[model samples]
Target: MSEKVRLVILITAQPGRGEEQVAAFERLAPVVRGEEGCLQYDMHQVSGDPDRFVLIEEWGSKAALAAHDVTAHMVAADAASPGFRAGPATVLEISAESVA
Candidate 1:
């Protein structure tokens, strides 16, 4: 089996679109969670910065994460970007190592 993939996405809302951005993510959560290989898909809003949101996701593998990028829900989310985003989202892939 391949190693699990972890992704962290930071989304910043446009001047007055924080609520809309949150709503969009809420709508997308279930769809993403239902995809194959998805382990977790959680969203969080920054306590001090209402316009900042974070998405923490875990997938079974790199392939699974790649597959998710082409899904209809993702496409829809990309298409609706202008409605809520202040700019391009920041995405990061993470890996962990254990110490013995």
Candidate 2:
């Protein structure tokens, strides 16, 4: 097998779009997990801050992570929030090859 890795996405709100962003991501998770190469898609909120949302993802490979960027759901996630804070989006990935 090629191996697998985890991808983490951190989404920060501009000001007050937290709830909307969370809801948007929530709707996105179900569909994202169904996408090819996606092993796990989970959303998280900061313990103290409601405006910060995080995404935990697992993929089969780096190529899979790259492909996820342009996935229809991603595009929808971008467009889904016609009303997001749109502050910053951080994407980080750990490749299986690096671990071993």
Candidate 3:
């Protein structure tokens, strides 16, 4: 069986553009959640920093995550990011494992 894949994506919006970035993601969450093998795809903003966001995601396997990367919504997001994002996102990927 393939192991689950989890990712923490850190997004920083351009100064004063946080609302635009959040709105864009809000429109995207529903579509992403409907994709196959999407176990979790939730976005959260930093406690005191409106311009900083975190996307927590979980997928059934590496293949599922790969498929997600090329989806239309993702592609559009990438194309539009430069308008509102500070720079490239910081993607932190992790694989499920037994620590005990």
TM per prediction: 0.91, 0.78, 0.92
> Cα miss at 21, model 1 (Å)?
0.9
Top TM-score model: 3
Question: Clashing pairs in model 1?
Answer: none
> What does the lDDT come to for candidate 3?
0.92
Stretch of 10 with least lDDT, candidate 3: 91-100
- Please provide, for model 1 over 19-68, each residue's C-alpha lDDT reduced to its tens digit, 9 standing for 90 to 100: 99889988999999999999999989989888899989999988898999
lDDT of each: 0.89, 0.78, 0.92
Q: lDDT winner between 1 and 2, please give it.
A: 1
- Give the candidate order by descending lDDT: 3, 1, 2
- Compare candidates 1 and 3 on lDDT and give the better one: 3
Residue pair clashes in candidate 2: none
Query: Candidate 1: deviation at residue 70, Å?
Result: 0.2
